[model samples]
Target: MTAETAVPAATSFAALHHRPGEPLLLPNAWDHASAAVLAARGFSAIGTTSLAVAAAVGLPDGEAATREHTLRLALTLGSEPYLLSVDAEDGFSDDPGEVAELAHQLWAVGAVGINLEDGLGPAALHAAKIAAVKAAVPGLFVNARTDTYWLGDGDGDGDAKDTLRRLDAYRQAGADGVFVPGLTDPGRIAHVVRCVDAPLNVLYSPAGPAVPQLADLGVRRVSLGSLLYRRALGAALDAVADIAAGRVPGGTTPSYDEVRALERSVSARASANSTG
Candidate 1:
């Protein structure tokens, strides 16, 4: 797939339905190089992190400042040999139509999936937005996320109820998936999974439940979110600190040629696809 290439009409957002216990492990990539490298590593699908995309452009995360950069990334990665899902935070505005337009553009650029969040907004409004996006791009996967856990509700019972209410509305509005970022308890995760009709997508945390445990708990998608990007930044800082102290970097550095070869590989693929 390319910016102008025609994609098959049958491939729609409904294709994101999980194959039972085999969940989709979606890795978040910030740029074309990062996305291409992950695709090369055999990931069947890739997701974008709004935090990474915002940080890369020096904008505040969750402030709706990187729509262009997000779209550019989608256009760049959608052609890769894998499905692409974008994390479009809060749909960039409260207007559902604008959000639907964004989904339309994503579909035009070959994106097959997208993740939208409510950020604790009214559940009915978010559900309407989900329905609008689905109406605009019927084949684009709409992973509706709620920030009840990430923020908080002061009481556990209240938080659970709010999260469940949002998930119910999202499912009714035709969302293909529903995500809860901070729910990691195996029992609680299982409870939510059983409550929703759509596949449950959980954020993968280093301190959270392992993949096998999550699988056992019935999670159908595991999103890495910004963990990899944060780790990459930490590694860069560590390497710089080591050099400043006159110490060699500890990690295995890729040979200069190997890194350069990635550029060539991407260029070759782009050229070949252009001609083919």
Candidate 2:
């Protein structure tokens, strides 16, 4: 579909957060093909992983280096069937207006949501960026992320206190949701849920609580941030090693036709939607 046809998807993606007991399981994609395959598999919403985007382009993540690449990917996947949310690491700038402009461009390209991280910076600055993005494009779901826990070098009590403080600032600044990535403890998760009025987004940890557990703890969004990308890389390496060792690689590898079918289905659906 054209970007115009994808405009209403923002509302649908916003509604996904309000479904109780079923947090939006947001699987992040790195590029057009990954997003299309996930959309074909029936994921209503897909997020872009900044790490994957950076790694794919041989750039380092979290350094505000992949702005152009991020925009390019957004332009490519903007019209897909699934709702698109971009993991814009720190919005690629410290200036609130610049970050808001980035949000504007993403929205214009048909992105429904944007994730902005504080990177443990000053909470006030991060809040200003959120406020700017909201003012620029209020329809975009701003998942305001605070890395206090993720980057904290303090005790649990101190980290929780700081995280709550940052989240409060973000909420006051008009964030649609708040995310604390490194938080894994059930008690801490429940505490944050109780304290925050907006939707609480938690990163899914393989060694931590599962989706069901996170749902039980009152998380509105469960994001698989970069895990799929990392796993894909790992699988590719393992397959190559197995081939060199003369052992059959064991994994659910999709056939070439299946992948091509995903591409064809996307094109067909876009054509049909555009015509309708």
Candidate 3:
């Protein structure tokens, strides 16, 4: 598949969440090259990072400001061979209908999944958004996110109760999965996994459990979130600093032709599809 050519995938994106001990490790991509390289390296599904998308356009993440930029990226990567899941902050609106419309547009452009964060907003409103997206595009996987942990909720009875409450509400609203980005405690993670009815999705934190540990705790999806994008930016700074100091960069860097080959591969597929 290319930007203009979509091929039916053998496995559904939803299925990637349920391999028992082998949880889906979704590396978030910021642009074509990031996504293409991940796909080339055997990741069957890729998600966009909201922070990267916002940064790319000089906007802020979680402000519902990157809607158009997000859509533009979906247009570019949706038709790729691997599954594409977009990080659409709060669905870019408070209106459930508007959120549903965004999901429809993403799906129409070939995205199979979308991530919608509640941003510590009203539970009812987020649930409504999830319900609306499901009603409008039943085939599109909706990973409903609650910011209870993301907003700095610590490990307490109150925090656990609130997190469970929001996750339950989102599940009832037809969310295929639920994400809690800041939850890291092994016991707490296991507690939520056993309690939440829907598939558990958690942000992969450096301080938190690894993929195997997350799988052991029953987390179905582990999202890298904006880690890769942030690391990429950090790497660029490191490389330039190294060159300025007369030292070679240590990280593996792709050659100019290698990057060009990625573009040509997509172009070749587009040409084949257009003229086939």
Q: Which predicted model would earn the best TM-score?
A: 3
Full candidate order by TM-score, most accurate first = 3, 2, 1
Between the candidate structures 2 and 3, which one is better when assessed by lDDT? 2
Number of the candidate with higher lDDT, 1 or 2 = 2
After superposing candidate 3, which stretches have Cα over 4 Å from the reference?
1-11
Report the lDDT tens digits of candidate 3 across residue range 1-276. 332333244137888887788888999999999999999899989999999999988998888898999999998998777899999989999999999999989988888899999988899999999999999988789999998888955767988898999999999999999999999999999999899887899999998888888999999999999999999989999999999999999898999999999999889978987899
Model 2: runs farther than 4 Å from truth?
Answer: 1-7, 262-276
Say which prediction, candidate 1 or candidate 2, comes out ahead on TM-score: 2
Per-model TM-score, in order, reads 0.92, 0.94, 0.95
**Model 2 lDDT, residue 41, Cα:** 84
Report the lDDT tens digits of candidate 2 across residue range 149-265: 788863568898999899999999999999999889999999999999999999999988999999999999999999999999999999999999999998979899988887787
> Candidate 3, overall lDDT?
0.89
Better of 1 and 3 by TM-score: 3
Candidates 2 and 3: which is better by TM-score?
Answer: 3
lDDT at 102 for candidate 1? 96
Against the reference, the lDDT scores of all candidates come to: 0.85, 0.91, 0.89
Worst 10 residues of 3 by lDDT: 2-11
